[model samples]
Target: MATTPVTQGSTDRRRFRVTGGRQTSPQQPALSRWELQALLLILALAAVLYAWGIGHAGVHPYYGAVVRSMAANWHAFFFGGLDPSGWITLDKIPGALWPQALSVKLFGPYDWAAALPQALEGILAVWLLHRIVRAWAGPLAGLLAALVLTLTPITVALNRHTIPDTLLVLLLVLAAGSLQKAVGSGKLLPLLACGAWVGLAFQAKMLQAWLVLPVFAAVYQLAAPGSRLDRAWRLLAAGATALLVSCSWLLVVWATPPESRPYIDGTTNNNPFTLAFGYNGLSRFGDDPHALGAVAGTTASRTSGNTGWTMLVNDIVGPQISWLLPLTVLALVLGLLWRAGQPRTDGRRAGFLLWGGWLAVHVVVFSTSNGNHGYYTAVLAPALAALTGGGAALFWAEYRAGGKRRRALPAAIGLTALWAVVIDGPHGRFAPWLLPVVLMLGLCGTAGLWSSGPRTTPRALHSALAAGMASVLLAPAVWAASCLDSRYAGSPMSPLAGPVGPGYREMRHHGTKPRPHALNTPSVRDAALLNYLTAHRSGEKYLLATQAAYGAEPLLRATSQPVLVMGGFTGLTPYPAAHHLNTLVSAHELRYVLLTTRRPSTSAVFWVKQNCTRVPPRAYGRIADGSFTLYDCAPGV
Candidate 1:
């Protein structure tokens, strides 16, 4: 998405600047030497932050196993099917997995390869966001926004995983930048292109991608040069194009005979359309009474008392993303006020509306929805960074303009900084030097903004701005650093938002652990199970069966042998009913079953206990944590 910020792009040719009404360049030049150097420096920093010691970042094993399976066959790859044998498709569309599958396939399906693509994609998002902001505001704002996004804890955590959210965000940013070009230049093509990018994002993540549609329509209607009627028609055309692009994959997957492909994993009826509309769609906004868990396998029932306006303060979201919440709010307010004096059709106002709409929509939807996860806050990171970064820079410029507005800008920043420090302050386990550095910057920036001195020393202003940036940047930077240093990894990535200390608590709700349970791998127990399964197999369709993918994942990745996950992801879904499992056993299609002591369904545990011979712990080497029991489906004839 952030394809080299070169000069002469369609979006850059516009006359109006996002920071103000400055006009000079006919075609925006490439990043100057300082700009390029600065950009690379931050990108390097981001790379280190995102990928350093990344192999240890315990990515979800279920997803990792699916990618491994996907690498074995293209049909499984295309369908996001859970297994290579094409037994069940993953809950969501397969678009997001394509890149991960390729990476795993090419790199031998290791943890590093599974996560590297998403990390790189997240880095691209940083650059793309910088370019987009730079095109609207200026280089300074762009750099600031980029840095803020880079340090976002949730951003780091999610990017370090194999989840599709990072890629989905990159596609959205690309779509938004294109839409801005369409509005600025009155070009139909850019609008179509924007639709295409967003459509692809929809393929990556279904209903959530459409959140920005209203903003896109409004920006074109308000700012594009064409007549209102003309713009409306063009908008409709773009919408149709988006629909076509979004549905392209869905149609193909749906058109394929159900019997020929795997049953869509998350749906009751084995249909992609039903999965999209049911489990992964509206069910995300509200829990499905009949369903056992969220599509993301997160529980929405834990509120931490976060509802209504208190949503911002909730233990779930506050630490990960709300550090700059106040600043973004101020940005929306000030950005709007700054533009109110200009033409009603001013593009700056449209930019605010676009980011503001995005901020508001996600906040409200996540705030109100019971099905929200703490990691869902990753969606909020970009909008907050764009507004706060670009908005803060805009205020600094206004203050340099030397008026009452200038004085107000300092007070505004000071208050916002105060809010951020208060919200995230308790979470920082900083060295003694850290607080002083943050305070000094806050004071210097506050003084510079507060000063009514003559316009003689710009260095003072620069110092103040740096201080402000430092103050805003400090806590999240520290916390994100802690996230890397801690043993923390895996899904529900946002809850571990604070530093690795007291305030950094996980959300224990809806029958799930508050944090990722440490997975034991490469252990003697696992090796023993693998050895037993490998030795006993004789033309069986599956070498093993487990209550959930979690137990079988180590073996799945260790060998090419197929494993039947009796219950899907959560181990609660009623699958391969007792009789059906017996049928498979009778046919010698499955032999070994591993019953994890963790949340297996009652019926499933009962079936395994009554029907199979329980292998003694000593017979299979050391079983750590007393968490799993290996059973022989039928040891010998």
Candidate 2:
């Protein structure tokens, strides 16, 4: 080998040359062995959190319906058992069903089988998030981020359920992380992977996936200095890949015969392709503004139009979860300040800004839209976690630079741990005692700033402090897990002993009743109905129809039946009569109708009750001590 000693600094900023055969600066310490072990522990905890109440929780009803529906109808929509019917009928995308269907096929229609994948995915998402943040910001930031997400109340709740939200969260994190990598390296493969992740996200929840990419691209553009054309080309490629991946299902559906379409409601346009792309795609932004008023029982005529910005904000952000408002505002201010102070060479600062910006965009867009759901706010967890991590990192770094820096770190850690104990400790249930702990954490951060010593003290102290804060944040989560165990240990109603105010008491009463209660025991009734349909049905080739859209999951579970609701898309609700049911009933296409008392007014039940002779309610077995009723719609007589 010819020996040419390498220089320490190369003229080319982009290129790296080994100096005297030494590695170009030791690899940055992303995760120490201890940090790795801690992360694995956190991941294990997340898995347990997601898996503990999988089958026993009331959340299973909705997922059960999805599994049962897919098992029964996969052939009808895809293989031609029910001619003209497709695989899914909900207003949502078909991406969520594939996992559920696979679960049913492998695990034999078990609710846990359908739910376990989501739990595992949720854990994977948390782990991946930790890895991404740790790589960029160091293990401390990564640990804080992971802990925040692990303890998030809504994140924990969504992970245990079978809905698409958790899956979407996982996909979004993966896409964002891939985009972060692609932006750094400008490699085509990472960008393509980013596109594929976004496509999966879209498959999970439709166009919400697209909303995240622009935010990521803008961050990349600002962080990386490149020709405008180059950036544009990369974005275009990524977009094309995303579209290709996301539209694969739509393409399959489009190529199939009209009779082979598995879903109802949104499936029947003069041009199914146009309807799928445009109406289902863009119409949601317009339709969601009216959903709240519609939910509140206001007529479309009486409600403000979808374009009204104020009403949109009120509907989506204000009522969804009021706790998020202050935290979001604080995070934005802190994120901007953090970005402004950082040196340009510190890529981690840019990553923080980008993640924070992505979070802000989610809040802003969702807030301005007409569509609102409490769970939709779950997307903000990563941003909040990052912001909290950043704040804590800054505080800890400052604390580590002082003469009393050694003491500072321990003091901060001790104070934080004490706060967690006082506020969230089992004995601290009295509301009056909670204020001092909050005041102490705030004072500790404020006091660190006024200290004459170096800034490192505050950063190290806050890092330790952040971990303690995460413990406090997670106390409710620990309690919730214990409550779930208690619920499963005896009766589902046993967990209700602690909270019994008017609202919950009413819910308990209604949940115990035979009729459908949307809030509490909807899942129980749904599961029972699914079981009843499955035991009574003879053929693997039966078509199941539901007037109630939300009830589709339970129904699906009971019979391993395919449903007629809109495939999980945005505007598949109030399922149209002249278009959806009239065609199916008149053609005598469906074998059975699983009617529930919980049907929304726009459901097929209302229409069937009005048009067809009411069939007698057949006794479906009870679940959670509540009864489910099944009805058979006679062939067109």
Most TM-score-accurate candidate: 1
Clashes of 1: 0
TM-score of 2: 0.70
Off by over 4 Å in 2: 1-30, 60-63, 72-88, 267-281, 287-346, 402-555, 561-637
lDDT of 1 by residue, 1-637 (tens): 1111212223322334333322222354578899899999889888988888777654565666777888878878887767777777666788887898898888875778877888899899999998888776677778888988999877887877667788888899899899877766667999999999989999888878888888788767776665678888999999998999988888888899977887665555556776666667756555563343333343422333345666666654576778887678888897788677655456666778888888888887766766455566788888888887678767766665555566656776577667765665554554445656666777777877586477747686667767777777886787677557544433433335443312233322343334332222445556787776777778889878887666867666655557787666656445667887888888888877888777546576688788898777776676443888878887463
Question: In lDDT terms, how accurate is model 1?
Answer: 0.71
Minimum summed lDDT over a 10-residue window in model 2 is located at 1-10
TM-score of each: 0.87, 0.70
**Candidate 2: global Cα-lDDT?**
0.53
* Model 2 / residue 61 / CA error / Å: 4.1
The candidate scoring highest on lDDT is 1
The sequence of per-residue lDDT tens digits that candidate 2 reaches over residues 345-436 is 23544566667777767767765765444456667777766655554554455344433322433344344434444323333432334445
Off by over 4 Å in 1: 1-25, 291-308, 428-436, 487-495, 500-521, 572-574, 577-579, 596-612, 622-631, 634-636
